[model samples]
Target: MLKSLQNIFRIAELRQRILFTLMMLAVYRVGCHVPTPGVNGQVLASFFEGTQGTLLGMVSAFTGGALQRMTVFALGIMPYISASIILQLLTVVFEPVQRLSKEGEQGRKVITRWTRYGTVLLSVVQGAGIAVGLQSMNVAGDPVVPNQGIGFVILTVFTLTAGTAFIMWIGEQITERGIGNGISLIIFAGIIANMPSAIVNTIRLLRTGAMPPVTMIFILVLMVLVIMAIVFMERAQRRVPIHYAKRVVGMRNLGGQSSHLPLKINMSGVIPPIFASSIIMFPATVANFVHVEWVQKLAGMMTPSHWLYNVFFVAFIVFFCYFYTAVTFNPVDVAENVKNQGGYIPGVRPGKATSDYLDVVLSRLTFAGAIYVSVVCVLPTMLIGQLNVPFYFGGTSLLIVVGVGMDTASQIESHLISRSYEGFMRGASIKGRRG
Candidate 1:
């Protein structure tokens, strides 16, 4: 492991890329501390203290506690993420987008441009809403925004929208010139940045006898088990064997080879949980700010600890697991590609039959993956409701952290192997998401 760390810096390009990524992430974290103009940070923090199970808390987590601070980056990268998800959905339903998606690099650039546009638009709306919401919010008799007016609203809208756009640009730069998927890394960085504070709080509770030692032991054990499960599931794959037909080209025999298509159990990766959480939290988020009787009641029932919320959360996870898998991986295309290359699944016909076989295999894998993700994610809420475990130790956060770590390590290993250096895992390699 130490040698691998040394080898990373031995390659100048890889070292530079990593350093650059770190520098960009640091810049983002710095922005998270720079508060918006008018809001009282302490009061905002106090308000968030009581919002632990609400949408505000979830948003704050994703933003590295920026929302609680009312920082410039309070909106975070969520608007951009939401826009990207919207665009992905559009690719399936909109014919023009479908055509554009098939056009390769140029098409993707177009889609990305549109996604950015949508991000800016969303940031503006969300920022304005937040500004107005702040005006209405108070800790006791003290307003969150003491000097509230139209001026504050416009300024906040501009500040937050610009912050999100800047974050979007940073992610793109990191992806183009640094390592890993930059957006994932940004979220990973945000979640990780909060770990120290959570640890400190946990220790405070332990020292004050608010949390029993046995409870702490159980939390540690559960975390370890959950992490191990996630690692195993993320690495699991169902490899379908394929054989290339023997063919003669001139005087030489060619094209007699065997390979297996690696179909991952969680082909959808961490997307289902993210989408499910966002959708489930939307109404609750609105209810948190708006105090209508029905809205308040609805939010109460959909709290993270509520049975109704868990039921809906699990259902959404299962639904999105299948939906996202279908969107991203088309069995028909894979079968066609295989057939064009003179390859066939051992027990299946080339074309449609092979497609059907792959589809069946994928459906089963997706179902299992969905169940695994739902169980992991829902477990935290069960603990929270029954045992009062902190939300900081959520399964979704761990999933993203572990998944992103694996992906980054996989990319790093590829670079190492390409340069004839040993990877972190001796005599082995981590399979990337594509595999």
Candidate 2:
């Protein structure tokens, strides 16, 4: 591992990319500390202290606690993410978007441009709602917003919208010039930023006898096991072997080959949980501002610990697992490409037959994936609720952290391998010590 770290810095280009990504992340963290104008920071903080189990708490976690602080980046990268999800769903139903999606690189660029526009629109709307909501919120008889008015609303909207746009730009720059995915890395950084504090709180609980030392040990062990499970599942793949017929081109064989199409056990990655959580949280987030009896009742039913909430959360995760898989992977296209390349799945006919086989395999895999995702997500809520843990330690946060860390490490390994250096894992056999 130490040698691998040294090898990363040995490659100048990879070193520069890593450094650039770190710098961009630092900028994002710094922005999370710059407070939004006209808000009472203390009062807002106090208010968030009581909202730990709510949707707002999850949003705050995603933003690295920026929402609790009402920072310039309080909205974080959520608006952009939401916009991207919206566009993805639209591509399935809207003919124009579907056409644009199929147009290749140029089409993708156009869709990305539209996604940016949607991000800006969402930021403005959500920011305005937040501003208006803050005006009515009070902690210990102190208003969250000191001077609430249309002017403050406009200012809040503009500030948050600009902040999101800046974050989007930073993510894009990192993707273009740095290592790993910029957006996922940004969220990964945010969730990880709270780790020190969580550790500290756990220690405080242990010392004060608020939490049993044995319980703490158990929690730590469970966390390690969960992380292991995540790593294993994330790396698991279903390989479908393919064979290519030999082609005789003038006296030389050119086309005979064997390969396998690797389909991930969890093709959707963390999208299903993210989409499910966002959808489940929307109603409660809106209810926080509205005081209607029925709305409040509905919101209460949708709380993270509620049965209805878990059911819906699991259902949506399952739904989106299939939905996102369909959006990203097309077995028909894969089959077509393979057929064009003179390849066929072993024991399956080419074209439609191959496509049908792939779809069936994928459906089974997706169902299992959905169950895994739901268990990972819902189990944490049960633990937190039962144990009264000081911090959010699992669910979507864990998944994203593990997934991003693995992806980034894989990219770094590729760079090292391309430079002819030993990677993180040494797979080749070594000669006997005496020899």
Candidate 3:
């Protein structure tokens, strides 16, 4: 491990990328400390500290404690993600977006441009809502904001929107010049940045008898088991065989090859849990700030302890797994591409039959994926509800962390392969002893 660490710095390009990503992440963490205008940070912190085990706490954890601090980045990248999801759904429903979605590179650029615009618009609205919500929050019955006027609201909105935009820009820069998927890496950094503090907090709880030491050990063991399970499942896939018939071209034969199309069991990646959480939490988040009786009731029904919450949460994960997988990976298109390239799944016809074959395989994979997601996410809810444990290492958090880590590692490995350099695991082979 030490040798590998040293060797990373030996590669100048990789070292530069690593440093650039770190510098960008440091900039983000600094922004998380810059308090939003017209708010008492200490009072807000006290309020969040009181609600440590709630849904808000979980969201705040993803934001690297920014929400707890009520910082400029309190909103994090959620609005952009929500806007991106909305746009994808729009592509399914709207004619123009649907057409644009199929237009190849230029079309994708157009859609990405629209996504950026939508992100800003949503950020404005969400930032404004957050501003109003903070103004209404009275910590310990003392209003955190002295004057809840237009000035405070507008300033808060501008500050937070700009913060998100800044974050977005940093992510783009990292992707262009640094390494990995920049936005995801930023989020991964945010979640990881809080690990040391979470560990200390868990220890403090043990010391105070709020949580037993055995509980802490159990949490550690559970985390390792969960990570191992995730890695295994994430890597699992069904490789469907494809064969190309030998073709004649200008007195030469071409197009005969054998390959397999890798269809992942979890084709939707970490999207299902994210979509499920946002949808389930919408009402609860609203109820946190408002006094509407029906809304409050609806929200209460979805609280982690409620039977409705667990059932619907699992159902949503399942539903979105299929939904998102369909949106992102289209069987009809894949079949068309395969046919265009003179390739066909052996024993399957090249057009409609091939599409049907893929649809069936994808459906099975998606079902298993959904079950895996449901099982992983449900365990944390059960632990929190039944055992009253503060296992902040929830399935969603683990999914995001592990998924992003795997993706980034894959990209790094590809980089190594492209440059003819040995991979990250080259010298540290698991199946053999090091020299």
* Model 3 C-alpha lDDT per residue in residues 1-435, reported as the tens digit of each score: 798667667777877987898898899999999988789877877787756556777678778888888898987877777777888888888999999988999998998888788778878987877777778888668887877889999999899899888888888889988888787787787788788987787778888999877767877788788899999999999999999888999989997899999999998988888778777765576577665788767766766667788899899899889989998888998999999989999889999999999999999999999999888887865675565665355777888899988987787666656555455556774676567
Per-model clash counts, in order, read 0, 0, 0
Q: Say what the RMSD of model 1 is.
A: 5.3
The residue ranges of model 3 lying beyond 4 angstroms of the native Cα positions read: 421-435
Candidates in descending TM-score order: 1, 2, 3
Per-prediction TM-score: 0.94, 0.94, 0.91
Model 2, C-alpha of 417: deviation from truth (Å): 2.4
lDDT of 2 by residue, 17-37 (tens): 999999999999999999999
Model 3, position 106: C-alpha lDDT score: 97
Query: Considering summed lDDT, which 10 consecutive residues are worst modelled in model 3?
Result: 416-425
* True-structure lDDT of candidate 3: 0.82
lDDT (Cα) of model 1: 0.87
